[model samples]
Target: MPDFLTLANHCANPRQGTQPNGLPYYDGQGTLTEEMRWLRSFIDEGYLWYKEVPANLNMADYKTVLDYFAVLKTPLITASGQPKDRFHFTYPSEVWEAMSGAGVTLGYGITWSRSTGATPRVYVVTMVEPDSPASKAGVLRGDTLVSVDGADATTSTALAALSPTAAGQTHAFALKRGESTQTFSLTSQKVTEAAVQNTRVISTSTGAVGYLQFNDHNAIAERQLLDAFTTLKAANVSDLVLDMRYNGGGYLLVASELAYMIAGPAATDGKVFERLQLNDKRPPQAPQMFRTVSYGLAPTSLKAGVTLPYLGLKRVTVLTTAGTCSASESVINSLRGIDVEVNLIGGETCGKPYAFVPQENCGTTYFAIQMQGANNKGFGDYADGFQATCKADDDLDHALGDSSERLLATALSYRANGVCPATPLRARSSSSTGPLQLLRPVGKEIALRPR
Candidate 1:
């Protein structure tokens, strides 16, 4: 590191004078947000090197930044700019009504708790899309989520637990419908999950080519992907189109598994996956520990059912945006290391290269942040996000009515220039965009199994 005083003096010189505040701020004060203050202090103290910044300085944590500024970006707003929902969060209550009436697909809907309604005094199923996972799972409109993964459902604890983790596990659910109780089991497979709203299809293409639209790298993602790929292979699908736009990310290993599936045996080429800068207090965990982290399918032999050398499918095109963070970025970062051409689009990514290993100190779960020294591609040094090879309309909501503008179209165009053929299709927007918005791929509706 360079001398801070000398650096500050050099920066303050007439030719390269310091600016007012160039860094993000945190700490919730009306004035003098802590991040900005520290940055200013660093400049004033002549700290020139990047290493001098505090380890806790997370400019990439949007929630922390938003809280520091006392801002809320997801509030529901009407055309007239009036707040639509009293609580700032609102959903379609009609979907709940339809589901309560035993309807199958409720289209797109939202839900909430009510204490006085017909199935009142509990956390009732307030909404359900007609063919969503909740709907397919037979979660009726008035059904009460009693417990999820052993946690009180009303607290959203069980719902949050639905976040994907490594393979070999299951998510348990207990529900109450009328006077009877039932349970459901969500087996995490390697296939991509239904997006947030369980609407859009992330994978769809003509011929041997397959498309996969994934949102998060959750525990079940690996198994879900494996099954999806196997299904695609059985269907004679060869080429692959992976749509990963606005994928804020979930688990890390899920990303690794996806990478290996696309790269096949070629992923063995050592490369970077983004460096993990650790907090001095933490250290790496032993590779042999083999701790059971989440409830989902356990990792199995990638060589299952294969006699010949398993060469995974060739390269893939990864959709990207500023909203893509954590494990999503890790996928792009790692894949690019193995000489895989990651067709980047949209704005700069949410730089979250540090790997968070879950740990428990006193009953409280803490995420011990560390960085990948290297990925399977052996390209871990590249950080601060990869620059986009091309750009697209990241503001999908604004482009919904604009027929000529689409990020997926741009991605497909680029795909055609490579080994994949151009297909006349539209990519899904996001998982949370609703099921009616989901691109229908494969799968059939089955009766909800009782837990």
Candidate 2:
């Protein structure tokens, strides 16, 4: 393969100016076909399973660049019989940048979870964004979607038609919430999703336990986390129930900061939060340390260099599910690395110890696995996902952060008595933010569950 670096930024319709980083685009004479070759070279060199990718496919057989990318992934399967890599894909560079950088998106802010088998598949409201139109329309979490625009939206095909694209796009949703049925009109708009929600100090029998539903590790999450930790710290909480059930994941830096906040200086002072190992061809990169201070990422009031607060707790309870992934798992893994007891409560995580450096060429940004990560303890082989210590059902009946909610309640129970529940919950539905949909799709990260 030739030097793919030489063909970098040589766009078909080149931008004539500098990027936001003040770096000029290395735009040279190029075509779509040339861009594919550049991507091929990059994958051949950097992809984590570079040797596993089929090398015999002709590039001319692909119609679009994205089509080519879809087939360029490793076809290996995990021990659990799941696809080895479902998280490989590309998107418009602009969309990825906006979402990961600022948690920005154009939508009604209703996160969905689908169940199948019957003709009329059930679509449940897994989560609703704070202050979003769906929230304003009184769309509660766990509401079963009955219809879309007065039409039955039970089939998978019908679900595909309910895409929220442009702002001002209006749609009516008929939902079943318990015994009652309600319909609401919602206009799609630009939604700036918040990372932390329902943060509060719960007075448990054991002690004041802090509960916070962390949805993603986007940039906006930095300040929100600081605020939540500050609140929990000020309240003198003895334990924490970090709800990451719906969280996919995002920025590694945010995860490091959060780990430090939970375990504090005594445990995290010199500990590595995540150690990234690139492909065998590349030299080993430096490990990410637990950050005690903020980097002051944008869309927030938190300034850089402020010493972050710490809970200094020896044990932390993390609420998990199949949707919990990437950096979220990093938090669980790193906390365990420092001997900080991380009691998990839900289903297994979305197991992704792998990550990639997003590379943009022409108009689309591509994500291909380039690294496998381990904690300071050097144990990172949970690709099948981290299983729960106490298996709990995702309760749609109770509001999140409510002490009675299944996951949160179970966590509180375990703290009171050091044991899991007698019975495991068989959930009726699970989160359905498949490989194709995720929040913060730009970076080497993920989310439900959102975006």
Candidate 3:
């Protein structure tokens, strides 16, 4: 007899269907009957596991077990939330990672049909890029995803199962827009945004400094960072003031690149970038490291080395808030490991350190276990949430004036005279185009936000 999981895997990845139903029919050869019995047992075990879930396990652990079994049997459903059990599991974390990694804009907005009278739905939009595959496939805003391939994914699990590999995989999406339901096929492609997001820059009021911000890191974060550096160097900006107040973490490599850039290229000669510790608390595989090239010690080259590079930052003043999370915190914690000046300000950050990767089981999508420990400087679990070194001291309604104004002002003071000022920087402009102007000038309390 085949192993339980082996049979399950075979069931999930069956041979070509002989007829209308996608399932393989039972011949008297006994293979089909035995497979069916194994599948039944597998389902029964999963039910038992779900029912026997330990009370002591945290939500994350509980979720992991539930997810492991879901891969064995993915349930499919139709557009009206109909049960379409032809598919496998749904909501496998890997699907979420792959979709987001492919540069899709994921948000939790209420998706409703007029007939359903507003049941909560997760709204996914394929925002167009200059020349991406999604744009090429004619996917646009207001287009609702109904299913991937022939699998019905009307629920969160179904949605997660649509994770496509790479940017070039062909994805068939059944969608709804306005009042019409339709289907379209498109090759997954990376979206390139003209605006920069999660990039690092340095301007000098007295000396070199840091200035970084990002619109999104899903696609071209690495490119944006390179561009920002080139522009800042040309403009003779010094030091650095990283602006990640709006960044939601995306590709892990991009975050690592940012860390390498800020750390320079010399300090990271075969050093750890960060570690991923599973719950078992075993020492993570050797910390992933990156080398730097050009500038500082090696040569005054803006280009970085293929291997380890510099990892030195005199002082880092990270401007953050609640929007900061995951890869964002990874970059921050990595920098802190080498003793970069991390003046955390603005607000608290969302704590998520587990890195995720996708693995498919017979089109029943799932995530591979790929997270690490939080010993980035032995400063304890950075996931406990890093509080602002300078917490805001004003009311919530006055958020703009209180949090940002105060944070930026203190950062400027520290850079200018190595100490915070008694008063906060006043606001100047609030125009969407003028982000830098929103904060007071780097060295002085000159309100820059447009009125």
The C-alpha stretches of model 2 lying farther than 4 A from their native spots are: 15-29, 116-119, 155-157, 426-451
Better of 1 and 3 by TM-score: 3
- List model 3 lDDT by residue over 1-451, tens digit each: 3343555444422434342234543222224443444434444343212223332332233233334344433244446464322213234333433333333322221111111123333333423344555556565544655776767655655555344435556656776665776777766544334325333343344765545555344433444566676665555554666766545565555666667876776655566776655333234365656434322111222334434323256567777754566667777787777767678766666555545443333334333223533435644264445776655321111222122345655666666776554443322221221112011101110000000
Q: Write the per-residue lDDT of candidate 2 for residues 1-451, one digit (tens) a residue.
A: 3647878876667776777668876677778788888878888888888889998978899987788888888898877788898788787877787877788887788877666444445677877888999999999988888888777876544464355768898878889988899998988887888889999999866689899999878778889999999999999999999999878887778888999999999998788988988889889877889999987776356778888999999999999887788889989999999999999997788888876667778768788877788998999998888989999868777889899888888988889998898987645454443221222233434521111
- lDDT measured at residue 445 in model 1 versus the true structure, 0 to 100: 9
Instruction: List TM-scores for all candidates, in order.
Output: 0.44, 0.92, 0.51
Which ranges of candidate 3 are over 4 A from the true structure? 1-99, 106-195, 198-204, 208-210, 215-219, 234-236, 279-284, 291-312, 362-370, 393-410, 417-451
Error of 2 at 263 (Å): 0.5
Q: What CA RMSD would you report for each candidate?
A: 17.8, 3.7, 14.3
lDDT values for all models: 0.42, 0.81, 0.46
lDDT of 1 by residue, 1-451 (tens): 4232222222111222222234322112222233333333332232112233334543445333223222222234556465322111111222221221122221222232333323212444433444444556665544555787777764656655443443344666676865898886644433322432221223335334455556545434545566666565565554555656546565555565566656655454443333343334346433211011222323342323322222255566565654566667766766666666667755466455545433211111222222343544445553455666665534332221122335555655666564222432222322223211112100110000001
How many clashing residue pairs, candidate 2? 2
Report the error of model 3 at residue 240, Å.
1.2
